[model samples]
Target: MEGKPEDDGGDLTRRGFLGGTGAALVVAGVPTLGGVGVEEEGVSTQLLEAVPQTAIRVTVNGTEHRVEVEDRWTLNEFLRDHIGLTGSKIGCNRGECGACTVLLDGEPVYSCSTLAVWADGREIVTVEGLERGGDVSPLQQAFMDHNAAQCGFCTPGQLMTATALLDRIPQPTTGEVREAMVGNLCRCSNYNAIVEAVLAAAATSGSGGAQ
Candidate 1:
């Protein structure tokens, strides 16, 4: 037999090196965005499209919104970015910090860890929602009165958690207040003031209702 060409020993051309001749990537439930598609050599590729979207109806601060959100987005991102409610800060970007806490159906939850899709048909309350008739809620006023917010970064989360406690107990003891707010970490270490504010609000008006 004739000697084979040296090039026949798998000369690694870019095209030949590829494992597959035609490549396609398809993800279920993902929608294509506005972009152009190009085809070459019987292979088709699309521009980067958005991730999977979920249309949800959520009531925030007594206002209902029907919006489309990417499935991977967190609740904090949805509120601050999409809904224009930036009170919930993204501190630590994890559940531990509690800076992104918000009330979901009258319960405090870490928005940073929760998915926006989980809020479908549910009520959400942020620090912005604590106002009634152009006036801050009793709990908020108490916080200011007691100077509970030193840095104010964690105030929103603290206030949200306190609001839930007062709503349930309506007059939680100092120990109860401390226990309930344990999840919220205050960098300023103003625990006493925060507890005082919550107690004061409860004594005056336990209307920490999620409005």
Candidate 2:
């Protein structure tokens, strides 16, 4: 009979879920090859390879942050992992999909392609920054009212791009709206709702929309 595969004794065991301590042990880090294995001393060895870090000062959501970020880390990683801003989703990672979009200096850009180090001394804004106090911005409310966010993966990108457009042209025609949001792709195929939401937010710009 073939022997069952041995448990490598990884950090997360089945019982960890019940106690809740197992999940805490799974720290985010660079995992080395064969890092988890029983050593000669009968101890499981797991090590994280530390990477070079760079000091950067960035203004995110109107708040300034000075942090040491890994040189190899992308803007998306810095925002989601370091700053605890998980609103930017990592999709297509190559800039083809704009799910990882964020505003850099008031312009929409794919955070996945932008390096964290490159954001030094620059202003950045993610979807989480859309709310003022406890209320969502009118642009965000418009998206909800029009049912623009189907799966919501591409909503943030669409919102940022549309926001930039509105800032330039307070009132945009449907064609202009279409052109401005061309880069943001909605996998849910809800383009019409997204366009309508932008238009609605534009119409209500004086109310409480993103200003």
Best by TM-score: 1
Clashes of each: 0, 0
As a TM-score, model 2 comes out at: 0.77
User: Once model 1 is optimally superposed onto the true structure by TM-score, how far is the C-alpha of residue 119 displaced, in angstroms?
Assistant: 1.1
Instruction: List all candidate RMSDs to the true structure.
Output: 16.6, 9.1
For model 2, the stretches where C-alpha displacement exceeds 4 angstroms are: 1-50, 206-208
Best by lDDT: 1
- Write candidate 2's Cα lDDT for 55-102 as tens digits: 999999988999988898899989976776878888799998788888
**Whole-model Cα lDDT per candidate?**
0.84, 0.81
lDDT of predicted model 2: 0.81
Please identify model 1 stretches exceeding 4 Å from their true place: 1-32, 35-49
> TM-scores, in order shown?
0.78, 0.77
What lDDT score is found at residue 93 in candidate 2?
91
